[model samples]
Target: MEIDSYFIGQLASEEKMKEINPVLSNVKVNDSNQLQFFIEVNNGLDIPADYEKYFKNQVIRCFESNLNSSEWDDLSNKGRYFRDDQFLKFAKNKLFIFKVDVNDSLIGTRLNVTKNSLIVKEKPKNISSNNEKTLTTIPIFRDFNVNKFEKNILDSKSIGSYEYLQEIRSPYIVCGEYLYGEFKNFEKLNDGWHVEYEDQIKKIPIDFNKYKDDILITEHALYLDENFLYDTLIEQGLEKLGTIITKENKIYVKEIDNTTNDFIEEIISEHEFLSTYKSNLKAKNLVYDSKQIINFHTSIKTRKLVILSGPSGTGKTQLVFNYAESLGINNSKSQFNLIPVKPSWTEDSDLIGYLDTINNIYRPSETGLIDTLIEANNNTDNIYVICFDEMNLAKVEHYFSQFLSVLELQGNERKLSLYNKEFIGRVFNADRYPPEIPIRDNVFFVGTINQDESSNSIPDKVLDRCNLIELVTPENYIELWSKSISNSLYKNELKQENKVETVTRSMLNEWGDWHGENVLNNKEIEIIKQLSNLFNSTFTIGFRTLNHINSYLANLPKNQELDREEAFDLQIAQKITPKIRGNSEELEKVFDEENGIFKILSKYQFKISNQILRRKKKELDIYGYTY
Candidate 1:
């Protein structure tokens, strides 16, 4: 019977209940302790004449002592109510709104961002009425390379010269977060930026350092530091906030968010990699199977190294490249790198760049792999892809040995050795080229391998380290080919109406924890052990291999059209069988149709694995080999 929440509405009498359409007059806790509204409705859309007056009266009552602890929590957590904590004064006559559902329950639209900023440091109400009219706000807009704006317009010293400065009516201009400066009679103010008012401002004691770059003509830079803005919690969504933004559309970060209208990442898509794959199918005419695409994504998440191995002209390389294009990074070289691994690449130097011992300057590789990794480490929020096309052209085990070892480790422990210990202190430009680069989780490596005569065999060490997926030809290949060929890749088409969600560095880091403390369930563990024992006679399955299989299962998107048995069947074919490809003679006993892997697989009702074993046995008999 306890009422812990209130909805603004006209309190109806028992006699007048039929007149109100879904008029919620009371709230009560049901037997389950869930809040339930008591509504009285007629079959009409028409609202009563005194509805607003009654609603406003109830709102006033709710705002007073009637609001319980749960309602206050809802106000802050669910973004349902405007906060009076900061210096946000609404216009006296501005009408407050109650966004409600059909049952008249309050609907919280703004989430995680509606709260007032605690760190913005309240600006002075003392700026006077005259100055408020002449005040304006601006973001760190210099990142845009506008012609005159870059070279001359923002030149603080030459501010009085440009007619654009004269057009500015605001005397006091706010720039980046809470920092503001007076725009008095030309001559821009960079150092004298202040966080007005005493409460939040005095504690932080922030100043502007004119976030400058080499592109400007003069030594003076007219920009504010982004870090400073972030440090003040302005970068975080404290929407309806004036500290970072309240001027333009009343949101945070005017430049990036407003331009593209990119909302929260989760709002776009939960399964970003799979979502982007489907988007590329229609938008770019890609013909890779959805299951294959899903497997590829799960592989990437489970193991940072994904090897796309198959016959030539099977879109092995195209799949990797298309992923970058689908991420809206087709033109961004920093985030997308396609390195054509050469036959001559015996060592890692050709890809990671060797330290010039003579000059002490670290010369990074031209392939952009090292640079992309470095950028990934710095910008952990972004996702970086490095595709080694025809990776098996050279011996993969030799060139990729460093990454193979490093990928086994996690977080900061995964550093790639670049220089000798003696030269570490002496290495010049160490800032740009550290002694060893941290192979962060943000960068995922994909290698395309064609199992042709020209390519060398991928060793057990390499196989154990990566998720090896052989590309399967699409069932409707001819139809998909015709569709793709007819659709021009270059010509303009309708822009993607839906904002495609991109998988980021944070998502990559979070994959390990997606499952419980133990990645594999007891049943899964027992089956993998049985399978490993079956293959133990030939080649021992290491923890790394077991971990890969378990991770793939753990990271697979829910409702993925794959049952555990079906997926495990694929994993065995992918993770286990590929290791002993050419050496079918060694595994001849275990590969028996009636009594070996098939018997164990059939016992578990893994029909797919049983079928695949039959196919592999056929391949062994006819082609004298299997992978």
Candidate 2:
């Protein structure tokens, strides 16, 4: 066998190896050309006192010049040395292997060697220097083309080596399969990388020189950095961001992953009819205080429902229309929608909206009033109103409960349940659902009520929600009737001939003067007493009827205006006295002869008992003793 290296200890003698050798004496090379051998360094002897020193001093040697290629291979085989490529790669420049005792525990005492077995020593530390020093170094990489794998690794922005990753509880270096970093600032951060989609991670440095914008910030507005390591990133970005937020606690962000488009048109249609209103006539001079004007404004501003309850021919509907028209004049921006409420409207949707039978579309009728108001106010800031003519003929609570609740709902928009299948029979169908109506601040509601046997009684809740205004018919109905007839081009088309002859304008005005001048200011009781006593012999008046008459008379024209003057004579008036009744013999004699008008005038006129009674009798007989 060829010996290619020198040994520190002399080979054990043949006599010594015969007793302590632990392996077979004959050995051969394997396919890798490596040999196995054993020898007795000590023959039944205790370890040497300098055994540790001897082990440290041990070395292997090679004689390259003395051997041919085959001879060298043979020597390598005899030495049992194997070429390890992986070990060579790891030990390429800075790493080396030095044979040391496997049990050695000292760290820096370890030695290093090269392929040629050359030993190198570390420099000694100087003891005299006392300078304070800090050594900071970042790992540097030689130029290496980044492959797809490496690109992905960096994109992940991981924080440790591959081997170091397994030992760590979380493999941060390969976090989402990216290389790791411990960058102190954004400039040191990895760039020149692309992601599959968009990358949300952003970096902002904290140094003052790089910060161009405002750098002092609060903790509330911004948060998070590329790696989500600390809150410093949030503080820094917020410093640079410029925005004014007046309301406190108003800034935030959220990840909305699953967004969808829902119903949209119904929402738009529900808020289309917003409006504002004002009175046709304001009494600025009628009252000294602003309370009346305040009341007027408040009446228009806060109106939800109004009920004008009065007798027929009091111009109730006309007044409501006038109010609505007045609002049109003031609010020229848009016209208020006017809807006439019929007595037959019983269901809620009848006034709101319903699916049209002919066209299969949602149509708004009377209930359309509310829908129109909601639509007018849709998604905007404006005012609106809905006037209901003859609102109380139908049950107010039955039709208006939903409307009242909708009015009270606080949101700018009110979502109506139009398509709920459960509300099938009660209202509209599933085909048409009214979208939420953006609530407008200025939607006024007005209603008119005629107090008649055909009209329904108004509920107290409805009354509480309304401003009640009373109106009465004019006392001179004949004048109004005659004027209406005179203006009519259809006078010959009258269905009733007797309707023309029932009351004449001249007769009514002449009869109206009989009530005395300034009848409007007279007390109701005084008018009733005088009217009943004066007409006791002919027509009589009741308390309730007198009240009605007084209300009518109050609005009558006090001073008459005529285009032409008519002929008239001195008025002869009659009044009954108790003396006329007590003098029965005189009464009989007055009745026996053909009593002239002066005789009747004396019998009835009490202030002048001797006045001509026969003339009064004829006058009374012709006029039928009118009160």
Q: State TM-scores per candidate.
A: 0.55, 0.27
Candidate 2 local accuracy as lDDT? 0.33
Q: Using alpha carbons, what is the TM-score of model 2? A: 0.27
lDDT of each: 0.53, 0.33
Each candidate's root-mean-square deviation in Å? 20.5, 50.7
Model 2 alpha-carbon drift over 4 Å, by segment: 1-297, 329-334, 355-361, 379-382, 411-417, 421-433, 472-627
In model 1, which regions exceed 4 Å deviation?
1-267, 271-273, 483-494, 497-503, 507-516, 582-585, 603-612, 622-627
Residues 180-296, model 1: lDDT tens digits: 322343232221121222122111112343332211111111212223334342433222233321112222344565566655554223344444455565455657766678777
lDDT of 2 by residue, 1-627 (tens): 111111111122234334433342312234554332221111111122233343332222212221112222333445334432321221222111112222235552321111222111111122111111111111211112223224433455422111100011111111221222322222111221122222222222234323212221111011111222223333334224312222132335565445564422211100010101111221111111112222222234332344555687655555544344433322322335566677777777767765554553456654456455555555243345566777777887887766656654445544443334444444443333443334454565667777778878666445434445444443444554454356442342222222212111222223223332333333334433553554454334443233323323332322111000000000111112211221323343333345322323222122122232443344445653311
- For candidate 1, the lDDT comes to 0.53
